[model samples]
Target: MDNMKQLIKQFSALITLSLILTGCVSLPEPIYLTDEEVSIAAKVGITEQQYRVIKTSQLYQLSPRQTDQYLRILHEQEPDLRKRIGRIAEKNIGQPYELYLLGEAPFEPYDSQPLFELSKSDCVVFVEHTYAMGLTDNWGDFFKTLQHIRYNNGEVGVVTRNHFTEYDWNRNNNWLVEDISSIAGENTIKTYEQTINKERFFAKQFGINVPQDNVKTVETYVPNEHIPAVAQYLQTGDFVNLVRSTGKGAWVGHVGIIKVEDNGKVNVIHSASPAVRKEGLLEMAKSFLAETPERFAEGRTATVGFKVLRLHETANDNLKAKFDGNVPPIMMLNRKYEYLTKEQVKTKLALMREQAKKDLIENALEQSKQSDIK
Candidate 1:
């Protein structure tokens, strides 16, 4: 158990018996707690009522193994920011999109709150959580970091949340991420005006008031013709927002992070319809307007266009060193992707459950046990 974590080094060996729980060295089938299995949480400190809520709660779900690996990587691994971002994303691939946050979803067109969950997530939340983890290994720090990245002035709540990517995030979080559509690329840069009816959107969707002047109008995008010109300028870990032209109002249709291969091919990681997947950006560009007259152009099959944005920083030595334009498949995931065979998985899980039972009793017996960090 002493070998399980190195975070609270100040704590004596007394707490070691209470910790040392899990990991994904061989990504095992997640041990979903059945009613009886869930009851085990009581021995670990959580009450039965709390355990039920954990099972049913939308935002409370988190994979102990994945969360552990996330912090572990941040504490010790490649020091490059670009590679770190990719490394964080690999752990979340194929995680089913969780709909529990619809009531308070943050990536909608009009409004959302500064929510955080390391367990399950939708497309935008997927990117948001992954981005947050890239900043630090501590969960305590992850929340505040996410708030700053997701909202204006680092404030939380629906009103402060950045409902739109271009105006909200790109403009506000410039200190965190910069919009390179107009700056980067290998040729002449082209820009366009995008207007969003935020007043109407917020009013109708969230019963909130946004002045007409408050409606974002300074939306800039790299036109279709210039995508290729800017292709070379894109780097791995760069976030791309697929711009769409809906006659109703201005908005972004899809979003994902770019991954540049060693051979110079560019791909993106996103959770679209089926699941979170990494695919070629150019391949999707060819199909944007597949059946329409704009098919041959830069439009995606069901979308209108795209844009490029990279993490912002003045000192980018890590990116310069790591961003050789040759990214590995989802960062260096050789170890994270390791998997256990069925028999080994079962044996491991059984051992884990037995350990859980003993740890809980030891913790309960030691009434003065130190509180576990969240």
Candidate 2:
């Protein structure tokens, strides 16, 4: 019996070597849905064209119409909100990453970039879009919810956009998430204060003025040394802010979401330089910290800690109420409509830009005078 087993093993090794020498072995090809298969999967509201586009693409590649149908089906299959968020995020695991993907385009003509891009996303866009989709069941509601999360008071404009991470983003979306760093890492939590100067930032980045400077805010985070202990308390869909230190101070440099596996392993899902990816929490931290010496020697930033935010139990209900009257077929997307020639639109945009700069300068001057008087 032993001689027969050895012969079989030798024969299998010879066959493998022969195949390798002949170049007959290759990796398995990825399987994608066929056109007819996509047609079969298309629901009532999804068009054949839309279905075809998303047949081999991720969730981000789906059109608004297809999104509505997908969301309905998704909600039916996965009733748990946290799991839904994780699944929706996983669908875009390989989505290309791009910074500054959205702006108030045709709506305001201030930032001429399109309002939405389906192919790529940055860290903030990934998190915001994922949350928006998780909370709504239709495309129109998803758009409205996304707008609410992206801008202050749901106003779509350059100045209203959430620019300051701690000052604007955390404060504006407080209703959706709660800071749980203190509780989750109470034993090893650390706090840092940093000033966010949006006024100077806007002036330098966009050549646009602002009326006020965002004040300093205290942030609580769990230092890298304590991540292992704090990670257990983290649940799926929790927000993660990667904190980095500079000679000046510390700031929230990047962001992502948490997904705890059934096996009790914690992962951080984020969109970075190349694409959306998932990494074990400890593994990511180790990689970041391992490069600290080289990064500091090269005068580059290094991640020092993390701040986690717990999702609110009432997030969906609150957002639904806020978006009660803001869906398509009933909600008006554009503020006003007027047909204009291409040249006319260009002229109007130039005029609007100039007017916006003027208004910002005036507001800054008024605020300066008020500060002087005080």
Candidate 3:
């Protein structure tokens, strides 16, 4: 009996060892910097510890802890928010492109996706994460800011999420950026209005019910042929929405950030199906217009124009004020919580989401009552 018990214990130990060796199990381990890594860290003017953490993760050479530290470094090195945004995004140039990368996971049962993803990103996730990271120096603040950018009034749910590009995302984030598509020059622009039925969109895409109908009225864009003229006005860190034409209707199909070169050239950096990459604005426009019928058959849409947004001059200062406990309750949590464990965060966020939903519904009811009284 004793030998049999010992044999079982040995077997269990071996199985656990195998799982750990094969990367099936994760355990926190101390990070040790090698001599070469230490040298490189010194050469780069960062501590060996910081470099070690940065190298541990493949996502833009930054682990979560490294991101917090690096953000501070970036802020110190570059005071200009627009240039900083471009620089931060450039670090993730080779990140793998993915679709539907984020959802409210562990916080709510609506979507099984996690709160954040570092290694891979879709166009929207890439833009949101980059902007969030650019604006904050820690994981907690980044997470909060990302939610603020992603959802209307910073509510966490499928119903409140900014699913539509022009109607929801652009409108909600107007404080951070301004739609300057019309300012790209009158001759270089086109205008169109898109009706967005969020009621149908939520039902079809997410299997959720939302009692809302929305519209993107009178959106201006610069057509692909006029990109050269439009590109002249584009500055670094400008938001770009790629407009796709289906011959029936149009939508902002993809999103990217504009990077202006020292040599006076404009570039669009985006994450597409294969991976993240940078392309000159004029060349990208030409390529889009040059798509073959075979490419279209393979599920590629023609990018007909671009809706551009410029960063607000006071965006960084405004964000800082919010971070400093001067935020409105509707826009943020109104108070900062210290670093929280995953489980604690999950519980708190779940409650917050429920509260936000209730608040929204009550506010709508109150508005309806006022209208009836009038």
Candidate 4:
């Protein structure tokens, strides 16, 4: 009996050891790039000009921590700015643009201001302050600030909402032309035209590449029930093949450049506002088709479109250098001097593993106790 008990104890120990070893081996090793690797990776398949644009762009060479900090700061300030504009607009119940311009109004339009005056150092900042806050009906005061800015200097860019229509054109065009003579008004039309022209000029000056004309429309070319393929493509970051669903049928949606990372994260950096975002490929398909899972399984179709855009890389060498040394490029770019080192990453991973093991053991013990009670 004593020998048997000792043998049982040894067996239990072996099982525990095996489970621990398996868990350790199953975890993926964190990959770190050397400075050289980072540079090389950035330059791969990109033109010299494109690379230069990327280097100068705000999105370049940002470390994860720096990105997080930038996002946090924006999130913090947005609410206050909105509140200030809201209060000012509320004070002036009914007022015309002229009233505000003549200092007869309490609110100032900030959206109409130049990019420099708006302090839009980052692309995300511009999107958040302009489109996200501008078009909302209740955000009139906040919008006034934007208008004031534009009226004082000049509109930076024009963002068309989800649709493109004559009404959309009329909004800014009448002002640009300074044609208040006609029903549509020449001034408004001219202002809109001027805004568009200025936007184009600035885009060229900054080397910002707008989306292709054909790519703007919805064109679907795939089967309705192809969720697996869509999910797979999204996971793999193959932006060239997107599934689109129109009212008529389902097809490949506009194929565009897609960048993906681990943790099921995906983002498309293009002409769209809110440049960086989390969009589920599957969710988009469902919404586009207006179909349930059952309908998709039953071959219900929808219309969608796909367009592919080539990306150019800039600061590839600099990015590579930082990564090669296990330094986070985003941190350097954002000037967040202190970032996680390889040692720190390894330590965190180990700590997480240890906690997981403890939890598992506790759960198993509880289960065993319940089984014995049964």
Candidate 5:
């Protein structure tokens, strides 16, 4: 205790900025630091006094407890993989809700990095964590597998972040997801161009001023009227990404795995705004429209096009492994101190922004061909 204070007094000018840049540590201001906190800060090169916003961050952790029965079903006896996925979500019912998880740096517009926090999570984080847990029994492999699923080409950086439910991840990770949308099938489905407000979205998340050309529009779906047909085909363990209106923020508003009840009722087990929870697929759709009647005018509403995706057995087999329940000791830290390529950043950013224009142009060209025939 005296040793920590002495170091603090000696290096009074050194602020928490150093620790903040590295990752998370204790004490931003000149205050008493506990032995554990002091050790962590010292190990990470974080110590100083200033405006402190310190709190416990629950990431890259094993669950509070993984029951033997849960383990047996998930890792051993469960014959059906979908049921296994639902069971994994069932184990994590009461975990707390955490937001701004990816934004943990001293500098503004916290750079993007692959974060694997399982103790607590928000909606999408909940789904990602559950999937990781369900797949890997070992924490180390879980972190590696998570990186494989969360980024492009399994590379880590701010620009490599994959958030889009329809295009970004769905396009890249064929091993993890099977696209059941109209494009992948022979059937013709209703589709529309969603103009992504990149400026508004990035400004809010990354705190960056984006160019007009950076905004993208892509051919996506509302699926307001067709959720039932889609839901019928969905089974347990299916990854359901609720693509909502752009006015809200990002394209994916909610995410969860499908759970079929004993009585044959199908529900979405997800973590939402208030907390992590489950809802009947039909009920979820009804509530979305009811909450904002003006958004749809007068019509039936379901989750912003419910992106029903199925996980392949090969991916699941590779991801799910035996666990010793040990925390991964080594992780790539010092992300805030690292630099990312601008061209790669812009290329990734522009890919998201321009999807809509390309779709619209193609649609127009098709219409013109029909007009000539008439």
Candidate 6:
């Protein structure tokens, strides 16, 4: 009887252990975004061109090999569009312009087509109409209209008249230029002059800014020539954004900026890379930013940096005090004014860094827990 009791107790203990092990084994595994996720991120909108690509490639029903081929073709075609637009810009560099189409291309069908392809004629008409109304829609035409323009020479004009009412010429170009020039030195024009300076241009072009600091700063193991000048604007506690270029050629393929974090590990906030939505540091850096380990190392070696400027106050203040405010008061000062105190910026940076560290740890633990369950 005693032996039997002991045997029964042992059996119970074994069963309990087995149950626990089974429970552990049954836990769910964490899911990470795959190449599909990255591909989804790359999608900008349901443009007509995208629809055409999708339908032509039969991506929805494609085999793995076919899908891969389709993606390759899409990537190859992206630069061709840019080249065509740049050719157009170059040809019309000095002309007082109106929108022109290469020829009468049929308007893409509305249902399956992307809205961007409403009509090539419509796009040209929009540009011409805006120009006539005294509004310059240069960036819109350049960046948005990719289909009608060919790879060869095409010309478009800048609006010279001030009589139009539909577009706000003063608000669009003159006011911002005057305002930025007033705050920044006159040389700002030579350095940062581009179509991107337009407010609508940047806002429409990019997505929402994350809740954290508009900018982030990071230190790389390698020497980056672009850092010192930008660093002057950063405070020790302030977060600074970062962007690094990726691609085999001279062009930058991928760009993202670092968000604030407490741990030494960098946290990035970006859209449409290896993953579509916003992600934490490890996933983002490991997946999208550093897709190729060799390329990542090479980028680290080159060390191009970035910082976001979400709010205009600090940037504007820095520009005013450093470049605009004091004339001849401080001779031998660097042409780029250094006015903000390090402490003011540092406080914000420290908070951001701490938040980042916590986020990373949470992400790791979650991943581990999920794996254990699986």
TM-score of each: 0.59, 0.73, 0.71, 0.23, 0.59, 0.21
> Candidate 5's C-alpha lDDT?
0.58
Give one digit per residue, the lDDT tens place, for model 3 in 129-211.
88887777666777778888898767776667788899889988886888988775688788877877665455445555455
> How would you order the candidates by lDDT, starting with the best?
2, 3, 5, 1, 4, 6
Show how many residue pairs clash in every candidate, following the order shown: 8, 0, 0, 74, 14, 30
Which pairs clash (backbone N, Cα, C closer than 3 Å) in model 2? none
- Which candidate ranks first by lDDT, i.e. highest? 2
Worst ten in a row by lDDT for model 4: 329-338
Model 1 scores worst on lDDT over the 10 consecutive residues at 327-336
RMSD after Cα superposition, model 5: 14.4
TM-score of 5: 0.59
> In model 3, which range of ten residues has the least summed lDDT?
328-337
Q: After superposing candidate 1, which stretches have Cα over 4 Å from the reference? A: 1-69, 98-114, 183-190, 209-212, 246-250, 292-302, 313-374
As for TM-score, the candidate ahead, 2 or 3, is: 2
Q: Give one digit per residue, the lDDT tens place, for model 6 in 1-374.
A: 99999999999988878877988535345444345434543553333444444444322234433333333434434333222222222222222222222321222111122222212222223222212111112233322212111111111111111111112221222211122211222222112111111222212222211122232222221112333323333221122223344432121222232333344333332223122122344444334323445765666332233322222223223323533553122111112212234553455446656866897699899999999999
TM-score of 4: 0.23
Q: Candidates ranked by TM-score, best first?
A: 2, 3, 5, 1, 4, 6
Per-residue lDDT value at 289 in model 1 = 39
> Per-residue lDDT for 1-374 in model 5, tens only?
99999998768645566776677665555456566555544443335221011212112223423222223323543556566678777766667777755532232235643265556677767776666656765555566666666666555544455656555666666667776655334342445444445444554456454444433445544364566556666777778777766344336666788898888788988876666677898777666656655665644333455667787766754333312333233233434322335665576557655875787699999999999999
Which scores greater on TM-score, model 4 or model 5?
Answer: 5
lDDT of 3 at 342: 55
After superposition, the stretches of candidate 4 with alpha carbons farther than 4 Å from their true spots are: 1-113, 116-259, 263-277, 292-310, 314-374
